[model samples]
Target chain A: MTIKLDRPDERGRFGEFGGRFAPETLMPALEELETAFAEAWSDPEFRTEFSEILTTYIGRPTPLHPARSLSEHLGVEVLLKREDLAHTGAHKINNAIGQGLLARRMGKPRVIAETGAGQHGVATATAAAYFGLDCTVYMGEVDIERQALNVLRMEILGAEVVAVRTGAGTLKDAVSEAMRDWVRTVEDTHYVIGSVVGPHPFPWMVREFQRVIGEEVLGQMGDDLPDVVVACVGGGSNAMGIFHPLAERGIELVGIEAAGEGIDTGRHGASIGAGTPGVLHGSATYLLQDEQGRVREAHSISAGLDYPGVGPEHAYFHQTGLARYESVTDDEALEGVELLARTEGIIPALESAHAIAWVARERRRLEGRRVLVNLSGRGDKDVEEIGKRR
Target chain B: MGRERLSSLFARTRAEGRAVLLPYMTAGLPDPGTSLALFEAMAGAGADGFEVGIPYTDPLMDGPVIQQGSERAIEAGTSPDVALELVAAVVESTGLPVLVMTYANPILHRGVDEFVAVAAEAGADGVIVPDLPVEESGPLRRAADRHGLGVVQFVAPTSGTARIEAVAAADPCFVYAVAEMGVTGERAEAGGRLDGLVGRIRAVTDVPVVAGVGISTPSQAAAAARVADGVIVGSALVRRVLEADSPDAATSELAQAVADLAAAVR
Candidate 1:
């Protein structure tokens, strides 16, 4: 009944990384988030209401299946933390639901979020509709074309979709444009960041909101923790959500990046694994930049993972040797998509498929040992891209 | 050798009571060939120096006009390597004191030492990175010094005395005084507070302090030059280029603007 975290440093980040790095315009809205989250998370009545909705309305405690066929093919035990079964069809809804509730509690009349593949947009829109809040989603023009179905799904949920045409006309630009809008309408709006990227407080805040995934997975796995935990890193929200709790549990955590090509080929979204420290948007994090510190164009088949920069916490994690970073090429991830579709009838998001593929290829090293893979999202949005590739 | 030459050049201009005209244009804007022609035209028009803006996608401190110019350059597929080549062309055509102005991101993306090496190789006299504050200028200053390139620094009106002292200490060339709070853009009139700001900066360092940002008209340049050592005209000149019927006309108009401003100050 009682929400555990509270206040400015809710997620407990050391200086330099975890404060809310919002502009002057968005300060009121961010302050509103602080007040709303504090109240909603602690109020037993609100907690019970959301808990019942998550369990009955959204299907909580999704089954943890031992991927037997996948294990057999890979010569090891592979377990999937079934986040794909969550309502809105991805783990993104978990955080979205929490944020939407907080938005309602704060008396905010409108909710806004930026999306790349539109999964987070759809998830946020779903929660907004459930809470009866006016929702607006900013999506990149390119992403709108790639994830047309999800865009329609958002529109069906009654959320206005605004296409951003600045910078690269992708996720980074979309977030920038949305933040600009939120700045102007801060008093009545809440900007729900989809991942653990953004300035201060966001990386830590989103992680805490989604840490429910790690808490449940640890409990569901019982007495024996897996030898390895693998999760795809797109802004690293899902990976960080599940990895943070298990980090001290002595289990190895691997965050797989969407490498459009191999790392050596210089065309990929492996920010932590392949990028250098540089400032982009607002935060100083690992980003793909040229010698003059200009942001370079990032390429990845998975729209969700194609970002030039990674979250600052991920950069911190990589720098402190707290987590291992890996890369999965588009071809390898596509194989993961096909593997899951054929074996378990589960179509994972191309972003999540990166982790799935890593598990398939790396499971050999952990033969006969347990491995928990964070099924970050489902593949509904990626069907078009996959179909074209095939 | 280059700093000495540039300093002596500034001294001669000051002694002759002639205002120094620093014409700025983005590399490969319009096109590389036209950029070269503009540089030649400005030099032939008795321009004192060149502040070459390296085209970047997100120029945090640039105005909309310069932002558009950068976008056009990027859309034309201008790369840093190509920009360096353009700088080389400008230097070859006009043996003038050239300052490369850009944001820190591109240089960091490229590797600091490599950028300095390339810029120096391109015959650039100095470099100005607007976003790199005095606190973070050591590495870049060292690199520039090693390559014999002057590291020009900016002193804003908002900077405290400590920061002014720090900037004066860090910068090798004349300190650039940003005339206003915002990015490079034309203003109807030069702000009234610049004279005091220039005097305040002068109290800290003996280096020549050049006033930039919003000094558009010949009269505005004359006013700025009365208080400061030099005047920088960026967005106004870029607008002249953009509004001109052709690139040739743009260069001629830009040259005229520079000559008119210099004569007014003189």
Candidate 2:
């Protein structure tokens, strides 16, 4: 199936899946951001500055490591896009630095962000420090405790880490609180949304900022596009980043969602797989909600994948049959971490482990076919949680 | 009831030379029965209208007071259906203009047309979806117009002149001029943008402008009333009900607060 990367039409809609459903107070800010990003994205100077930062600061052009041992074990050519080697240890830095630069161009003096696993927070904090922009990262109290090291990294980078105690005290709540702050501070603050979520300009802007991942893969692979491209879907930045360029290439794009236990157990973050289309966090998308449309809290051992909502573009892809979505339970993701560590000496983040687990599970079916997986982040942050589980 | 109900409320309040007092309360809070009584009490205490919030799981525009109230209301079994029933109850008992305030998901989830139809059938004067701006509100506005239910529009301090004009063109029953930039909560001061925002909206349309958000005290409500056509006091009143010792105390305190606000605005 072919997926068109050109979406979120003028209204920022991916089919019927995305639109600006934000509060009126934020409407103008979103419009301003959309305009600024458009101008900046097109300007050669802005492009040069952003690319320069990615290469010089973020250590971009991260290698496409061919995991020969893992490929042999799984009976498929496993190519890993090592975003795990990027600055701040995740693909989140690409969007953060790009948005941080855009924020500076927009003349916004401060930036606010929301994080679940704290990767985005750390990345944003790093960008803020580099850009000399005041930064605040809203994280759920639960996530703050679990991802304690990232919290310290953010603080050390001079970003204030505010713990959100509302709702389930997780990523969903952090996004809500960051939005609340942005509502009031829109005059001087830019909300650097970590993923391809939220209202207009955000889903589109973030996807464009993160498209470097796919673009790099295009150059690195040199005409031999993998038969299937896989990445974990938690708000779906890394997945969208990698799958976007290869979407129309006729390669199978698979998104792995975190099914905390199992989909049938009513505890999972498999939004597109086991959710209904609904509005949450400022856009219409597939979200885990009850019959009453009250968003249900999603569970994932990976905090970054614990959100109930998926990106609107992913929802559109699922609807158009452009890509396939599957789920992996927490235990399966854990085993994936162990497998990758033992076979390739690479400890993958629990978020990326979900994607690896899917590849491992479908190894027999995927035998002899080349597969590309986005190792979205490093597992250093997950070592504590993994230690406890082991 | 339709936009005419809200228009006439503002007209009557204008004639009296007093700003329309609309007290906001979360439905099913402190129990469904007590909330109904509080609305009735506010109506008796000279409130011109009421904005009854349908308890939602994620009320991003709301701060802790209303958020906690919503959580409690939802915990006590206030589904959208039950909340609409409460709207009907408030209408039946108050005999005043009642607007249903909620986020967009609930309305969209139930189908915009169906939700507006049910709200109108339940005697709602208007609907305030804070998150649904004019750009994304086409379907909702069309459905609301079909059901003769007014879709309330919002103009924040951050709204540009063009945005205010667009909101004015939507023909809202009334324009909610956010008194401040932040979420719904009590504040030390109501910020200095109320007058300018009201002026901007008045320059474009004759829609009655109601200032809300952070207008907690009677003095702040009076300050906002002096600038806009109406004043919306939510978090402060919701907090009264939340902090009250008993149902009786909550009702009495809420009634007293409403009376003070009404007198100040008058």
Candidate 3:
């Protein structure tokens, strides 16, 4: 059976998962963005410029480091995809820079984004400053409190950080607020959605931007694919980025979700493993919603992983069994963070620590196998929160 | 019991050389009981129809006022069932056209067919789903058509000619002309390309055009009604209910507001 990896058909439906479910007011904007993205993505000059920016500014071709000590401890040959080394300390800058260039091409002077842990916000702020575009980022108030370092980074980068106080004061609320802002100012502004989520062109476009990770990995691995490729899933951008290119290569694609307390305890952010199919943030996808279809608040120690919905393409991957998804609780993720720090001298972001936790949890099965994990971001911003946990 | 549908309400108002006044109220806001009373007050005060907003957890198209009302309704445990029941009660009491206004998720949650069927059973004349654009509205539109419920589509200033024609081709009972480029909120005055959008819709289809979003004052409503077949005042009236100290105060204030709007539009 040939798997069609080229997704988001003309209507943006990835099978039954993705679609452009947004307001009428923003429909034209979305259409314009779709065209702009398509033309920019196809043009050789645009691609060359985007590649040059990634190489020079954002630091592309992030190294794949073999975690020898950690691998020995887990009884697996674990290699970490070093997105943490990228400028702004995460893989988020890749997409941010891509969208920033696209916004420039579209003649949009302002770029707006919604962020969870503030990595995406910081990355977007960095890109906006680099491109001389006005930038605004909406972050949930709760996240603003926890990720203060990142908030400062965004502010210092000359981006306005708006605290979204609605709906659990988290990533979901920030997404809602950003959409509201875009609806009003869409004429001159481009919404730089951080993850591979949201309406039609967004999920597809962001995935393409982030696809650099997987494409780089294919060449780096040198004819031997890792038995498993793992990344954390919070709106699932980094995971999708690393997974889309290597999906058909017979490697196991695994996504780790943040289980705040526990999935059974109903406080986790494991949208795919625990949620039902519903629409939120403009796409038909699995959502953490109540019986009445009201979206529920997702909880995670890592603010980046605290989202009620996953990317629509991730939902499609789950439905088609293209990838397997597992979850790690907050406590387990903290333990993963400590383990990586002690063994490999690397402090992974609490979000990426979920993938580390999954590797540790399934160490027995992964024994003697080469596993690749996306170290999506650094843990510097999370050091304070980690201290509180200790 | 005879109840008004969107068609008759618009026909009667158009025959009288005036536009209908439809005031939007968030169902189960404050509480279901108080919300029903507010609907009654608006109907008695001369609301030609009603837009009963079902409070979802996330109201993306709503401004601060309606967003707060929706959050309050959700906090009060207003489930889809509870909201639809309120719609039924409002229909029974008011005997006026009542359209269910919600985002796409709630209906998708119940399964479009089941939601449309239950809404029709609950006496909802139509539905206004802001997020379900014409492209993604096929299932909801088909389901509503099967249940004899009108699907209200929106036309915005940002929409190009092809998009407006597509919305008109959906054969909506009415075209909700977004008077401004923003979400539902009370502006100091109605602004944006309202005339352009309404005129474009008129050229494309005979679906009654009702201007909504940012119409706060009666003068604004009257100004919009001059071009649109109706005027939908949402945040202005919902803000009153949200800010009122007492239910009676909300009801009386809503009554006066609706009366003033009706006097202007009609």
TM-score for all predictions?
0.70, 0.99, 0.99
Worst ten in a row by lDDT for model 3 chain A: A1-10
Q: For every candidate, what is the interface RMSD in angstroms?
A: 7.1, 0.8, 0.6
Give the docking tier of candidate 1: incorrect
Which pairs clash in model 2? none
The DockQ-derived docking category for candidate 3 is high
Name the regions of candidate 2 deviating beyond 4 angstroms: A1-4
> For residues A296-367, could you state the per-residue lDDT of candidate 1 as single tens digits?
777788888988887777776776667889999999999999998998889999999999898877766778
- How far off is model 2, as Cα RMSD? 1.1
For TM-score, candidate 1 versus 2, the one ahead is 2
Give per-residue lDDT, candidate 3, residue A141. 97
The local distance difference test score of each candidate is: 0.79, 0.92, 0.92
lDDT string for model 3 (B1-266, tens) is 11236788788889999998999988896687677888888999999888988888899999999999988887787877889999999888878888998989988888899999899999999999999999999999999888888998988999989999899889899999999988889877575588877888888889899999999898998889899999999998988988899988888998999999999996
lDDT of 2 by residue, A1-390 (tens): 344468578888888888999999999889999999999999999999999999999899999999999998888889999999999899999999999999999999999999999999999999999999999999999999889999999999999999999999999999999999999899999999999999999999999999999999999988888999999999999999998888867899999999999999999999998998889999999999888888899999999999999999999888887888999999999999999999999999999999999999999999978999999999999999999999
Worst 10 residues of 1 chain A by lDDT: A1-10
